[model samples]
Target: MRVARTHHRCARRSVVVGKPKAEPRASWVDEETFDAKKKRASLILRRLEKQYPDTRTALNYTTPFELLVATVLSAQSTDKMVNIITEKLFQKYRSPEDYLKAKPGELEQDIKASGFFNQKAKSIRGLSQKLVEDFGGEVPGTMEELLTLPGVARKTANVVLGNAFGKNFGIAVDTHVHRLSWRFGFSDHDDPNKVEQDLMKLFSRAKWFKVSHLLIDHGRNVCFARNPNCADCVVNELCPAARVPAVRKRAKPSPSA
Candidate 1:
């Protein structure tokens, strides 16, 4: 009888721990190994392509020079705020020469709503003067030349090159993009340069510009900072950061002794 019981116990143990079960998938990046991670990133890009087919520049501008200036003014300011200020500012200063010729204080007051009036004033004036002297009052297209201008970093240059010139030089890592990319497991690095490198490796060249805009829109509308609406999120199935609440406790009936 003991031998029979031992045999049954051994059978139960075999059933319980025969083969190792696969790890529970908590994130899209975890769905595959390193090589497959790149492929998964491509799939995510495809999903975004359908979601935001018309994804483009949020900033309004007619000319490349206008777009370049607007991108510079967008530093530490929202696109809406910059647009509000630029609506009149653009009408007044039609060209780089006009901006260079205008009084610094007047231009400063004109863009006061966008914040950092003093520094932004200097940047606008200095950048304009450089354009007049160096590029013959035209915004430079290449990344190398664009960086030579004051107040024009990788973020601004990338925005102008991608949106205005339709060039895919690098990814624009805005605050929303940086946060969302990290949450979505696109990158572990906090530095924008490193993040762009990771994204370039994962996504194809065609998605370089569009990917940032899609992520930015999603971050603002859904995955907001401080309080994300993960419950109603579209990508919640693949998101590791989805908020899951604990189940409610139920009262148990007393057992008869």
Candidate 2:
């Protein structure tokens, strides 16, 4: 009887210990085709447009030249901070010629609150000099010409082109746009240029400019970097990462009474 009871307990222990583990569900993005992703991207854009009606650059600017200077100063700084600095800076330096006239150190001191003051000051002075010398003291409207200016990459160029000139060259992949793109499975790339390319392919040219603004607004209000408000996300249903349940550790069994 003791031997029989020992065998019964051993079998029960084996059964409990040998239970099969559950397989992880495939990511929603993994199952989607190119056409499906495109369609989903369109749906996401439509929803986002409804959520944020006003799509505009947060940086305050009156002229294309002011917008260009503000964008240059906006690198590695917040729009609020840039706007604060630009308010006074704009009043002082009205044109590219004015910026060119100011000394780099004086300009650095003027924009010290924007962070990266020295580099920003140099870019401002360098680009201002270029604008005066090459483009007749005017901010160029074309992407090609804009790239020729110092500190004017695709992001800054796109911002100026889209907001100032009402042109859509490409999506401006800022920090907000970058984070949301990966979460939405629009782009797996870490590089901003590649991410912008992916977005351009996923969305139509008409939406190229407004898409960045929508994503930026959403990122700020909902999809935060550290703690995304997935529950209230506008695109939660379409998001692949949204369906994936957050993994939590199982509690250890307490000591038997």
Q: Pick the candidate with the highest lDDT.
A: 2
Full-model lDDT, candidate 2: 0.78
Which tens-of-lDDT digit does each residue in 1-257 have in candidate 1? 01110000000000001111122225555555767767666776777677667776667677777777777777777777777777787789888999888864888888888777888888888889999999988888899999998888888888889977789999987777777667767776757778778888888798899888887777766777657777657666555566643234578989989
Question: Cα deviation of 6 in candidate 1 (Å)?
Answer: 78
Q: Would you give me the overall lDDT of model 1?
A: 0.72
lDDT accuracy of residue 68 in candidate 1: 76
Question: What TM-score would each prediction reach against the true structure?
Answer: 0.81, 0.84
Question: What digit string (tens of lDDT, one per residue) describes model 2 on residues 1-257?
Answer: 01110000000000001111122223877778999999999999999999988766787887888888888877777777777788799899998888778864789899999888989888888898999999988888999999999888999999889988889999998888887787788887778889899999999999999999888888788876666787778777787656444444589999999
Alpha carbon lDDT of residue 125, candidate 2? Answer: 89
Q: Report the Cα lDDT for residue 86, model 1.
A: 76
Q: Residue 122 of model 2: what lDDT?
A: 87
Which ranges of candidate 1 are over 4 A from the true structure? 1-32, 244-257
Lowest-sum lDDT 10-residue window in model 1: 6-15
| Candidate 1 root-mean-square deviation in Å | 19.0
